[model samples]
Target: MERWPALELASTIRHDGDGGVTDDLATVQGTTRWIRAQSDLPAGHAPAGDIAADEELRTEIVALRRAVRALFARAVSPAPPSPADARRLMPADQALAHLNAVAAREPVAPQMDWPLDGAPVTRLLSAEDDPKVRFLAALARAAVEFLSGPQRTRLRACTAPRCVRYFVQSHGRQEWCKPSCGNRARAARHYRRQRTAADGGPAPGGPS
Candidate 1:
């Protein structure tokens, strides 16, 4: 039998809905937890409190999850001075660091930057056997689509004066939360001054 935690996470990911914040949070947390449980899930081995007592398996699973997350984060949101960014930040998935490196070593290359990575991330570590690696890799691609495609323009940081979370807009017309961030942001300037004075100086990070 598999651990309940892992199964619970699977359930969370499989949920279907409009994927609101509650949905997104549950999905993200489930995905994160599941990535951490890779080794255990593959074999019949799960951690003890894991409900399976598979120490070695759990260790390996954690490693796999970490790898996938690394690739996913890299693919989805790699750091700057970055190879992926050097290439067109569109058509998203074709820029795996490993693939770019392999292409570079070939003698017959094009003149136009053949993927424009003046200095790319060279160390590539991944397992050919893990299915999760592919799964997450694909997910990273979809995430990029959500980020750079039209959906990206729809992403808005809470306009709420004090809220710092981001939310996806449906109808392409929404902004900030209807309850918290939205109302808070709508408060008049006088109210903002009063709130600022009462809180003793622009609420920590100060107005952005």
Candidate 2:
């Protein structure tokens, strides 16, 4: 699947498989590892090998992630936000402001490169000298772009039990982030039906 920096950031907080949430950016080392693992980020956005994350950088990145996730919650609208941070989501207005502020930290201009043997490519040229600033700004900019793009309409919070993911629906009926989540949800429903039958309640899908 195609990767989006903003989506990737939001996904840092996910199910830990033990029926609890785990934050991938919970520590400086973890944050550094996460940043390094994002090899698919656009050029100029990915940090160099020597640029390890510090406490300040980790805090900034986590803050940006909070705003992105809050905006993602808004994008999904009436649907409940991811259970991981739903109760603590930043307000939509505050999140929007924070995202814009972070995105503006690095000034960038589109530079077009045309070669005789290949198609023209456009890349951003940033005025910011600090690599850390550039990285954070790039992430914020990606979130801004994603929120304003058509794909925002397809964003949905996974409803499967123990799942806390937000995924772009590939099909009209897509309800889970992946097939594993779908299978888990189905099994959960089956278990609930069996329990209800044992309790002498109405059968699954029957009149209450």
Q: What is the C-alpha RMSD of each candidate to the true structure, in Å?
A: 15.5, 1.3
CA lDDT for candidate 2: 0.90
Error of 2 at 167 (Å): 0.9
Q: What is the C-alpha RMSD, rounded to one decimal, of candidate 2?
A: 1.3
lDDT of 1 by residue, 87-169 (tens): 43323244344333322332221123234756433322333333433333333333333434554444444454444333446
| Candidate 2 lDDT tens digits, 1-208 | 7888888899999988889889999999999988887766677563645568999999999999999999999999898999989999999999999999999999998999999999999888888899888888888888888889988999999999999999999999999999999999999999999999999999789999
| Model 2 spans > 4 angstroms off | 44-48
Candidate 2 Cα deviation (angstroms), residue 207: 2.7
lDDT to native, each model: 0.36, 0.90
* Winning model by lDDT: 2
TM-score of 1: 0.33
lDDT of 2 at 61: 95
Clashing pairs in 1: 39-61
Residue 58, candidate 2: Cα error in Å is 0.5
